[model samples]
Target: MLKKNNSTPLYNQLVDVLIEHIKTNLDIDEKMLSEREICLKYDVSRTTVRAALNELEEMGYIFKRHGKGTFVSGLWKEMQNLSEAYSFTEQMKQLGKIPHSQVLSLEYIVANQDLAKNVGIQEGEHVYKMKRLRSADGMPMMYETTFIPAYLFPDLTISKLESMPLYELYPQVYNQDIKYADEEFYASVLQAKESEELGLPAGSACLRIRRTTYSQENKIIEYTLSVARGDQFVYKIRHSKK
Candidate 1:
């Protein structure tokens, strides 16, 4: 039941109600009530129901299929704040998800002009390239490619990354620490190869993030490009009034 007198808008109230219903009563992939049914039950207009549904979809609470109804999403869906510098594994662990990674490729290569510029390294320098598919609770989440100067991490190997988070190995194995990182984000449609890696359809919306990480001395440590599923991840930012 909706209270008309409450300060919250009707659509927002409905969104809250639906989220509660999904959390308590629905299972993953379970179809939710239709727009018409929701309207009749809540005594709201079609516009209001649509607004609520749209918000829910954006928040990863539900997903709609063509010619089909909306259904509950999996519990592994995660939200990330743009201001935080946590690694993917750390973030997932914070959200109570079991994080895992599959190392697709790992090899040493000479940095090209573009790669060197992004990583603050000289061109023709040797860099270790590592590609991985990250997952949470056995579900593919993001595909990432990371480049690290080989000189800084002489002993890094594919086996080490497959066993633990890369960040955790930094200080313990390499005697280097990541102090902070600069990230650039952009919207992209997944390519056929990327879609196959993520288990998503080609042309699915995704967030492409490029990150340059530095050590306490401001020396460039790593450069990484990652493609995250748009339907499963949300980036949040918080601003404070001065």
Candidate 2:
């Protein structure tokens, strides 16, 4: 029941009530009560209900589809800080979610001119290209494609990639130290194949990230492109007074 005369706005109160219900009563992808149902049950107007639902969507608590109703977005949204570097597995573990990666494909290829430039490798150099789908709690989170100079890591294999974070393996197996990395992020829509891999609808909004990693000697060790679900990730930046 909502207190119409309370200090809180009706729509805000409704948002809180709905969030509670979602946290305790709903499962991932479970359809929420219809707008009409919510209106009647809460004795609120349709306008009020829409306002609440809109806020929920923006906050990543739920998502809506055309011709269908709102549904619970099972996983809690992950917050990423642009200043830190952490593996997906490590970040998810900190959030109490089990993380896993499925190796989709691995192949040896010669770097083209564009690839060589991005990776700071000579043209025609051998590289190992690996594609992986990373997930948390059985929900697909990111589709990643990584390229590494094969000569630098001769024993690197798909099996090793599946079992552990590549950052960890670099030090242990190749005796390489990760000195730093550069990343760029782009707002984009998922393509047909990308959506299929992530189990998301075509044209879904996503974050396209390109990363270049360097070893202690400043040699480019890896270049990766990843598409992360926009709804499930939010990047936070902190500013300091200079």
lDDT of each: 0.87, 0.88
Query: Could you tally the backbone clashes for each prediction?
Result: 0, 0
Candidate 2, 30-118: lDDT as tens digits: 99999989999999999999999999887668988888988998545442334264577877886799988999999999999999988
TM-score of each: 0.65, 0.65
Candidate 1 positional error at 132, Å: 0.1
lDDT of 2: 0.88
RMSD of 1: 13.9
Local error of candidate 1 at 131, Å? 0.5
Q: Worst ten-residue run, lDDT, model 2? A: 74-83
